[model samples]
Target: MTYTAMKTLSVDYRLERWTGTAWVTFKMSSNNATNTNLLNATSDWTVMPGYYYRVTSIHTAYDGSTTETSKHVSGTVLF
Candidate 1:
């Protein structure tokens, strides 16, 4: 089975993945005032017939500039 998740964040903000004890960072940019930007993360897994995996954490940042905004959400996966 495969697991896929997508997240969108505004200008100056970013998303980072946790590698057990540390974080791998990814950056995003927005050039339009009204455009929605997105960030995506994916993972693959194989399990028993009744198994599942979960997304544990999401990290968000907003670059304290006066011209941009940001938002975030986190959840689990069921298959």
Candidate 2:
């Protein structure tokens, strides 16, 4: 969602899916400074049912410190 830095940090956001064989990053953000925005219905991203996904953020501080965090969402289709 958001990365807070003491000063300025390089941040990247990615949307990944578990495709049974591997974890794939379908969408990614360019290098950003400060914070990241959320992907919503208007974001032009398609949501497929019966898949596991995660929203991950990787942040690197000006001091060369780095940390990563991720949030997961699960969905299933009713056939």
Candidate 3:
């Protein structure tokens, strides 16, 4: 039996705020790894008192020949 490993892994983080009409990205950050399979990130931003905010993350993993990607969005909160 044989096993495989990913060549690279990365994530894109976006902080979004709900405007009166649509969601807008207020801040952004990212983390990546070239020799490992783990990634961690943290972000902090001040929000207005009467707006909704959330985080959206896009994760991607790639081997030598193939790539896989996924997206996750956190639950919205009012501040």
Candidate 4:
């Protein structure tokens, strides 16, 4: 997924089981007058049976000079 913003920026993601573990992949890039940014990530998430999973806003921001912020979340599913 790709996001482009002149003001506020946001992203949404979902990782579902394929074979063994669900692999979540994401990337973000921007070219603005103020700065240029690049980011990438990959993870294998496992979900058990008879359970639910929910993950909220994972955010990342990078300026040409530095990585500003990054966040992640993981939740269990309940049947």
Candidate 5:
């Protein structure tokens, strides 16, 4: 018997700021990996005070025949 497998993983990050009425995306980043279980990414931004900011992350993984996706949003923070 023989088996073959192919795996792919990707993550996308977005930085949002509350613009008094709605949340707007200001910065974005993407990372991808193959046949790996761990992925790491980083981003930096200069934020002004007196505003609320948040981060949204989208993660996706695929293994030969199946694909899964999840999304997460962080709590707002004042800067």
Candidate 6:
């Protein structure tokens, strides 16, 4: 038996650029998230054409049963 399950969410955004070797991570988030100006409005990083970038959303959920689950966006960016 379980008493109650509590849920919490913390959402953050990031825009990463490919440096030919590795993918760098940057802090990215917007109060009004849009596709028109996703990086321009939300991130401090600049957008470059022909460069691979990845937008990852990490999710973590926990309940009162001491069971926790975490999920991450998969796949690579091909620019």
For this target, which candidate reaches the highest TM-score against the unseen true structure?
A: 5
Model 3 residue 53 distance off true place after TM-score fit, in angstroms: 0.3
The digit string of per-residue lDDT tens for model 1 on 1-79 reads 0122213232333344444566444333332222233444444434333323333333332333332333543443334
Worst 10 residues of 2 by lDDT: 34-43
Query: In angstroms, how far off is 25's CA in candidate 1?
Result: 20
Tens digit per residue, CA lDDT, model 5, 4-71:
33388788999999999999997899988787776777888888889899999998888878888999
How many angstroms is residue 50 displaced in model 2 relative to the true structure, after the best TM-score fit?
A: 1.6
Model 3 regions lying over 4 Å from their true place: 1-5
Among all candidates shown, the one with the greatest lDDT: 5
| CA RMSD, predictions in order | 11.1, 6.0, 3.5, 9.3, 4.9, 9.2
lDDT of each candidate versus the true structure = 0.35, 0.53, 0.82, 0.41, 0.83, 0.50
In candidate 6, the residue pairs with backbone N, CA or C atoms under 3 Å apart (3 or more residues apart, or in different chains) clash, namely none
lDDT of 2 by residue, 1-79 (tens): 3343333445566677778898788787645454333322213467677787766665544524645444434352321
Q: Write the per-residue lDDT of candidate 6 for residues 1-79, one digit (tens) a residue.
A: 1233334433355677778898787546633222221212234566767878887654333353443444455465665
TM-score of 6: 0.49
Give residue 7's lDDT in candidate 6 (0 to 100). Answer: 42
CA RMSD (A), model 1 = 11.1
Candidate numbers sorted by TM-score from highest down: 5, 3, 2, 6, 4, 1
lDDT of 3: 0.82
Model 2 bad stretches (over 4 Å) = 1-7, 34-44, 63-79
Candidate 2 or 3, higher lDDT? 3
If ranked by lDDT, best first, what sequence of candidates would result? Answer: 5, 3, 2, 6, 4, 1
Segments of candidate 5 deviating more than 4 angstroms = 1-6
lDDT at position 45, candidate 1: 37
Clashing pairs in 3: none
Error of 2 at 41 (Å): 16
Which stretches of candidate 6 lie above 4 Å from their native place? 1-5, 30-46, 65-67
TM-score of every candidate: 0.26, 0.50, 0.85, 0.31, 0.87, 0.49
Error of 2 at 27 (Å): 0.9
